[model samples]
Target: LPSQVSDAYEKILSRSKDQSWTRIILQIILAATRPLTLDEANVALALAIRKNEPESHSKLKLELWLGKNFKSTVMNLCGLFVSVYDSKLSFIHQTAREFLTDSEPEGTWKGSFNMAQSHHPLLQSCIFYLSFPDIDVFHPPFDLIDDIDGRIKSYGSTEYPFLVYAAKNWPLHFVSQNAADANAFRIQARTLCSATGHQRDVWAPYYFEEYPNSTFDDWKVWPDLTLASYLGLYEAVEDILSKEKPNVNLATEIGRTPLASAITQGHESVVKLLLDNGANMKEQENDGRPPLSLAVWIGQEAVVEVLLKEGANIDAQDRYGWTALSLAARSGQEAAVELLLNNGADIEAKDRFGMTPLSLAACSGQEAVVKLLLKKGADIEAQDFEGQTPLSLAAGYGKWANLWTMLRGFVAIVKLLLEEGAAMETQDHSGQTPLSLATEKGHTAIIELLLNKGKESKLSLSQSISA
Candidate 1:
């Protein structure tokens, strides 16, 4: 089936008048996160060429080029191999897409449809479109629809149809491509990072409106290396560090370093690069989380390993005294927990609230983490500052009506703890036993398990008394 589709694709490419342009257009369609509008695709293609041309000159050339080739329309170019429904482009069938994207296509298509190769041009075009001077006009004040003509004049009397797509999707395509060999992408990314005015004032806020921990205001002050690392542009980061030894530990307004940014995004290569180049691993962010804790919390086991090997303090605690192990356990990072345990992390390390790793795991209903902790000799009945045992916390942590599945998980943890010989009648500071807590939360299954265990304990007591 794929062979037949590949044959058709070959014939289509052969019949196309301009094969290289057709290939680039096809790549834009395949690499686009969503179905691109016709105008967006056209702008993307135009930007792919003449990237170094000034916006005004580029606009004139783009219009002339489009006018000359407009009759070669996308539908007519690829014929039956492509489809246009509602003005969005896609392949004729899902199988056609499959044929093109197959890891090991035969004949001429082998290694021709590389993902990095496909995304490189799109990302390049996006950066080119964004670098236009007219981007600043899209910031505010004027309504997008009503002020179209004014903006077009600023864009050399041409509509910048792909501005929004380019602004928002550049990061998506940036990460999709291999950054190791991309000196061009590295330069563009670094240039964007170094932009103090437009990137900060316009595109950063527009692109990262919903991104967590990103303050648009901070973009003005953050070091270029920090921003580049956060964006996960490995080659770009390498470029910045290579030029000279800048202070890698320099914090942004929010007190995050390049290392912290790379760690948060799980960019292993970048993290390692930062570490090898003297990024301080012990420097906590304003939130008080050390690099090791941040890596463990996010379940970046590879990054975690790198940090540990780099001499990151395994038991380093945050401001709240939550050690890396505690964060890993609470977040259900089983592999991280195991790795920390194997690395001699204090399994019984306590947070400021005296909640151990086992306590947090049980309270968070991490069944696998809970089991692993127990096997590693975690105190099953360890009490927190509030005197809540692991069993007590698990039994009543999320007993509310909406968390039915959480209650079930708590029930399982209760049974596991009980089988591991956790005391059934253990009480908290408020004197609530695991059974009483279960009863209060209306956790019927847990209440039953506690009751059965209680009955068995009492029976064993009576038999010993009789003997």
Candidate 2:
């Protein structure tokens, strides 16, 4: 039911070399987590060669994925063994897929296609491909997405295929178990790291976009021992730590220690290993954001519990004066907020901007954090550096903010503030009331609610005047 089983098809694939390439084509189809595009397959087969000499690379680039006869060559070699769908390599039928992966003959499948071992070849191909002298010039301006995409696309056709594929997939190949590929990958990683800022910038964007989820490891900006720990590379972490009198607290350029990176990655083993080997749990990174703060910043509760148990400074603030509770509350991390509150974090603690955790929680529309902080006696009318209260903060008045940005839960926070008897007529140093801020932000719901509260407060004031 798959392909027409013609004798001509059988005759062509029966050739010994054709059969070998056929096996590789099938393997590429079977083991791939995503579709293996025609161009990707062509590049893969080209690099399947094992030579590492500079002369070998020069020759390979000439015969790369864009080789003149590349299309017909792959077609003749594949025969009916594989199919092309949407320009991606694949088998024709479900039966073909099963036959390849079932291992019915028990280990007779193509040696090159074994999912466990195939990654090494891909990894080698990537490192070799990226090693091109030209890659040294492909630098994105910053870590921003548009800059990255634009810079990665700057390579010309011959270079673009290898450039995109290598940039996109190398991390998977790197993490694949065949990591000890003659120590080549380690040297490649070191080489990339050792390159000028321009070269490293080209590769780092892909790592950020795909590798691990968005975490604070900061591998894109700085791939250090800390990043290795975060990626759960035990050998790499141990290798870094085993050096003579290693500074266990060494932070990345972003101020993240190995422990902070591991925590962000949620690798408990790496976290424990760092701590057992002397990672300072209290060490803060980029903005005085301590390891404990980093834990809650990403909402890793397991790491949070560990840091708390290890005696992390519960109230430690970043350079902006944000504490663990402040970050969790702002990000709507209820579990972390609860954990910090239970551990005696200062619920009403103010940052340098005089914005308390409650203030941030309300502004971020995190109702639970707002409620939790209020339950813990957060100063409802506390003023920030802008002389704006938590209610004003809920109305979205940050010290550096010029515009009244509408936030979620504005109505809920407004109601809660009114219920708590927070002064409705209170104004910031700019003389704008909470109602004025809400009106400016065009938050009609919150504006209506606050107007009614204003009328009630006026009525109470008139009654007191008569009394």
Highest-lDDT candidate: 1
| Worst ten in a row by lDDT for model 2 | 104-113
Worst 10 residues of 1 by lDDT: 149-158
Candidate 1 structure quality by residue, lDDT tens digits, 1-467: 64666787777766777777777877887788888766677777776655463565256344543532542577566777787778667778876666667777676543367777788778877887767665544443433534543443345224456766776688778878865536667777777787564654445644553442445346557788998898788878898999857898999867899999899888888999998889998899998999999988877888899899988999989999999999999988898899999999999999999999999999888999999999999988789999998989887777473266354487788889999999878888898998788778787777788899999999999999999
Off by over 4 Å in 2: 1-37, 46-55, 59-121, 127-161, 176-233, 243-246, 251-273, 298-310, 342-344, 372-388, 395-407, 419-444, 451-467
Q: What are the RMSD figures for all models against the true structure? A: 4.0, 7.5
Candidate 2 lDDT (Cα, 0 to 1):
0.67
Residue 265's lDDT within candidate 2 is 73
Separately for all candidates shown, the number of backbone clashes (residues 3 or more apart, or on different chains) is 0, 2
**lDDT tens per residue, model 2, 1-467:** 22343333344446536566566555555545566667777776676555662343456667765643666677777656567777777666565555444443333342224565656666666767766655554544544644444555555234556567676666556666364663556645545543244445666555564433343125555445665665665555655667534677877666767687788877766687788898887677766778888888887889888878877899988888898899998999988888899999988788888888888887777877788778888888888888888787676443323233334556677788778888878889999888788767676667777888888878998999999
Error of 2 at 449 (Å): 1.4
